[model samples]
Target: MKRSLIIANRLREVLLNGHWIANTNCKEQILSVNWMQATQKVGNLNMIAALTFHINYYLVGLLTAFETGKLEISDKFSFDLPPISSESEWNKMVTDFISNSEKFADKVEQMEDSLLDQPFIDEKYGTFLRNIEGVIEHSYYHLGQISLIKKLIMQDQS
Candidate 1:
């Protein structure tokens, strides 16, 4: 298989399903979480909803860069998760995540293998492959946090 397709599939697996390391994906992890638990502040840790939004924020930024050739995201506003006080709102966030992730994966899949080595928008930002891989790494890092937080929340409820 082509390198671009491999990277694209790997991204999809981590975001949606069948990730090798986690053995599950962000979608399953986020959806399995209770709505109330998502908003709960466990000690100094961030809310699950906030983490979800943070993950998607970068993905959206990368997608926008690919589509519009402009990178307009900053970390300061990345974790600004909307109020998810109701099940419907939480469900909507999850739905948005799924839709956006699908579109992002498709865009990445369409990239040429040569494009991977080319710098992403700017030379200082590094190559497309590096940025893409960074996204996957970032997702896994946060996925671990979400898993631990969920476990702690479950234990607290017990």
Candidate 2:
């Protein structure tokens, strides 16, 4: 099988479906929480909604790079999630995340295997595969946080 296909599958495994890794995907976790629960803060940790925005922020930036050949994302702005005050607002954010996740995987799946080894946008940023894998690792890290936060929130409510 092609390397791109494998990478894309791995992406889907974390973000969309296929739960062999963490036993849960972003979509499932995000969907499990209501707007109030998603926006609730547990101590100093970020809320679920913010984490979702952070992951989707990178996904959107990478997807833009994939399409336009320019990587314009900055870490400083990655967590600048707009205030989500209502269920509709929260739902829209989740919907955008799911849509972007699908698009990101599709873009990867269509890539030529050779492109994976090439530097993404520039030589300093390393290979496309490295950045793609970073997304998966970063996502799982935050997914674990989300799960823990959800538990903490639930426990607090009880």
Candidate 3:
């Protein structure tokens, strides 16, 4: 398999399912969660919904760069999640994450392995390989937090 395909597959696994490193994925861990549960805080940590948005923000940015050759993410605004007033709204965001993950992976797979060595958009941001693999690493990092938060939320409900 091509290196791009390999990275894409890893990205898909982290965002969706069937990842070997973690038994549960981001979708499995949060997609079905009720709005109340998703928005609940575990002490001082970010809520599940907020974390979801944050993860998707970078994914969308990278995908944008792939499509338009411009990286348009701002860390300042990345966490600005809209009001998830109902389960439907929450589900929409979850679906957006899934959809973007698929699109991003597809785009990545289309790139040559040699492209990975080139800067994502410019030299300051690092190579495409670094950013792409960074997304996987970032998603896993948040997945761990989501799992722990879900546990905490469940324990509270019990």
Top candidate on lDDT is: 2
Q: Write the per-residue lDDT of candidate 2 for residues 40-147, one digit (tens) a residue.
A: 988899999999999999999999998899999999999999999999999999999999999999999999999999999999999999999999999999999998
- With a 3 Å backbone cut-off (N, CA, C), the pairs that clash in candidate 2 are none
How much is the lDDT of residue 58 in candidate 1?
91
TM-score for each model: 0.96, 0.98, 0.96
TM-score between candidate 1 and the true structure? 0.96
| Every candidate's CA RMSD | 1.0, 0.7, 1.0
Off by over 4 Å in 1: none
Model 2, runs deviating above 4 Å = none
Off by over 4 Å in 3: none
lDDT of 1 at 154: 91
For candidate 1, write residues 1-158 as lDDT tens digits: 88989999988988988658898889989999878988899999998899998999998888888989999999899988878889888888888888888888888899999999999999999999999999889988998899899999999999
Candidate with more favorable, higher lDDT: 2 or 3: 2
Q: What tens-digit string does per-residue lDDT give for candidate 3 at 99-158?
A: 987888888889999999998799998999998889889999999999999999999999
lDDT of 1: 0.90
Ranking by lDDT: 2, 1, 3
Q: Which ten residues in a row have the lowest lDDT in candidate 1?
A: 16-25
For candidate 3, the TM-score is: 0.96
